[model samples]
Target chain A: MKSNEVRVARFDGYERVMHWMAALSFLYAALTGLAIWSPVLYWMAALSGGGFVIRGTHPWSGVLFTAVIGWMFARWAKTMGLDADDRVWLTRMDKYATHQHDALPESGKFNAGQKMLFWSQVVTALLLMVSGVVLWFPEWMPRSLRLVAIAMHPLAAIGSIAGIIVHIYMGTMSVPRSMRAMLLGWVTPNWARLHHPKWYREWRGSTNLR
Target chain B: MLVAKLIDTTLCIGCKACEVACQEWNDQEYTLGTFNGSYQTMPDLAPNFWNLIKFNEVQRNGAEAWLMSKYQCMHCADAGCLAACPAPGAITQLANGTVDFVHENCIGCGYCITGCPFDVPKLSPASKKVYKCSLCSDRTAVGLEPACIKTCPTNCLTFGERDEMIRVAEIRTRELKADGFKDAGIYNPAGVGGTNVIYVLNDAKQPEQYGLPKDPIIPWTVQLWKGPLKALGAMVFMGSILGAFFHYVVFGPQQEEAADEVE
Candidate 1:
């Protein structure tokens, strides 16, 4: 039971849809990508009709994922900007890892962990896109260039996947009530207060009618 | 059983019939690129195109050289992408040692992109799906050769049982070594749990000479960061769910007044 007095819409309906779309698309890319890469999960191709289907679907879904993530970046990049508090919070990540909620520093709309996830996504997305393009056009370029692209693409994908695992954990499991913002586009006052007191206060102080 | 490929680069004529056949058999469209280049039209593997032939010009032994090889999924045994996938239906292993993909169960996290050692998978923009080469599973289901194998004018690519392929690769490597290729050897038999697609290089050159990794391993960070965190997160999720269920069952629903008071 929580108070309903301090309610606010943290995300718009479109934003929530985009967030989920990005999430879903990214998931598709990751799974099929793995199926193509290794025999250990070659069975995954059955999900897409077979290995060929996974192959056909992986890149197109990646493009869609990148597009949606790009939209999410535009919508949230400003709020996700790092600040002094974020630095302090990042330096004290061990507290969060140990589940020391009381010692956890207060944050804004996005915490230090969330900000790191955002920026990692941004950098990895750029790297995957660039490397993917080179891979896509190997015949058009010199072999040396194609080899470089091949090497860089996998490395970038690996880093991005690792970042995403952390992002998913923080968003869905570790932080209570955080997923509700993305799910319902709103947050209860108490939840906002507990997790993002600064953002809660800012929203309370705002003169906007909504 | 460890599967391998013995790709004889010398046998490759750079005709690209293999690429065309793969596209045709897979019902993929021709990926046309800039017009001014040689017959190297289909640029690379996309969500649509699963296979491609790469052309390389190098200064080998201080002499100008041209090299060509067909490229597709390597099908590593300890696939990074498989280990990284979060969804259950995303990736699976087949009976014949081929890795497969499932689309209906996919949630599109893109974890596989990072897990792959070869970076083979590509994302499509229009349909929001992921795609890669599956080694012609459809054709194999009917006991037919892969389209690329059937259409290769030079017989550069071959498909067969995993064990038989490895045996042939070894014999070919030995023969190539006797034929003046002192460095000829099979690639990726034990590298990543053994690749199903084997390569027979043109000469006794390192795999790096033809743009393949000498040693590919799942990145340590995956084990370090994702492996443990995913397990811990699942535990938390289950614990939270069970805790909420227990609280509701034991304490019963809260009265409106009590709920209001807590708030």
Candidate 2:
């Protein structure tokens, strides 16, 4: 919007709030999880008022995270669904890393990589919630099952965290103005046209049909 | 002064007096409850109650059998609870092979609970600290036996040097074997460097029936995830940062929307 006279909406108020809530919950869960998983990261326990609080608070944070992510999935699952173009876009990662947008596929509301992150989060979030619940009150389940869940929770956390790192980089640097779109709920027509031309065409109904 | 205990289950009369003495000695107030089909008062261990007498009533070839096993911390030589403890001075291993918990130092993380192969440590909601059978180090340091051992009426529970206790347990095992109990053996499982407390069980084949693991070892999941996977996670994290840095060095800043490109 600052770059152009016309302001096009990207994220709604509900989407922005949900995103921040998810982000905060994710960060707290990750920190607490790391603090519990190994002693080397035990200093993180101090950040959350010592190891006991971190240990006790982590499962609840995971509950909040799962709830928020569930809501986000309900809202964004359709728009983020992958298609043939998205699959093709996956093959051109070198071009993407090098910033060759001209060689990339025309994207919809979300690009191929964003769609991958969306699906990855969908799976990881569910796995983490299930494993976290089993680990929280392990006595509720059999010891054999609890041991399996204990092994699973950290690996799920690792996966979601790695995806999130790439997502943050993509939003901030790889695709500049994406964070602004999420923050302000709008992007300039120029940004839309250059980054997501097919979406811009759909929104503006412009004469440049190509 | 490293102490150990020998529990002869064959001589145990299934009396809950040791359980009562443990509660009184530790000053842990647990609600008295109705019998839940078995003589055992409580179903499992609690933060307040550091000891338990698990009663298992199983039938063998149409004959009634009663199994009563006293349950408490095993206090291993290679303690996973101590290995997983993040706080310094929270858990200490004595020269006498007594693994002790310092409540003041416990940050109430419950990591010790999961770290334990025996499910011994319990976290209290009130104090937010982990508690377990201390092996009565408070009494042992003053040259007194543990309350449980002292209160055992049949003299089934005895305390002495850890090495001597093992020999006593072996002797009991031989006696049980001669008495027509073919499966008799000492339960000082070597999977965790053997336990400080030894058990001479009549039927050692099914330790699980007495709420004990047949082959207890520190969980492999804890070992790999906390040990090697951690380093790999750090590498992946640092790799991302370095990837970003090198991208900047190679490709420079990404191009934004061009001034001339318009709808």
Using DockQ as the measure, the top candidate is 2
In model 2 chain B, which range of ten residues has the least summed lDDT? B254-263
Model 1 is docked with a DockQ of 0.08
lDDT of 1 at B218: 65
Best by TM-score: 2
**Candidate 2 displacement at residue B16 in angstroms:** 3.1
Model 2, which residues run further than 4 Å from truth? A1-3, A206-210, B60-62, B80-92, B104-117, B123-129, B179-182, B208-211
lDDT of candidates 1 onward, in order: 0.69, 0.82
lDDT tens digits, residues B1-263, model 1? 43333456778988878777877877986666655364555555688887867776667899987778777778777776677665666677677666766766554545556566677766666554567787777777687877888887776777787788878877888898889888887776464677878887755456766666777666655443345544554455456556545644654332221113112
Q: Which lDDT tens digits does candidate 2 get at residues A1-210?
A: 234766778889999999989999999999888777666777877898876676678888989989998999999998988788888899997888888878889888788888888889989999999877777764455566666776678788888888887777777776777889988899888888777777887887743323
Per-residue lDDT over B104-150 for candidate 2, one digit per residue giving the tens place of the 0 to 100 score? 77877555677788988887777878889999999999999999999
Least well predicted 10-residue stretch by lDDT in candidate 1 chain B = B254-263
Clashes of 1: 67
In candidate 2, the residue pairs with backbone N, CA or C atoms under 3 Å apart (3 or more residues apart, or in different chains) clash, namely B2-B96
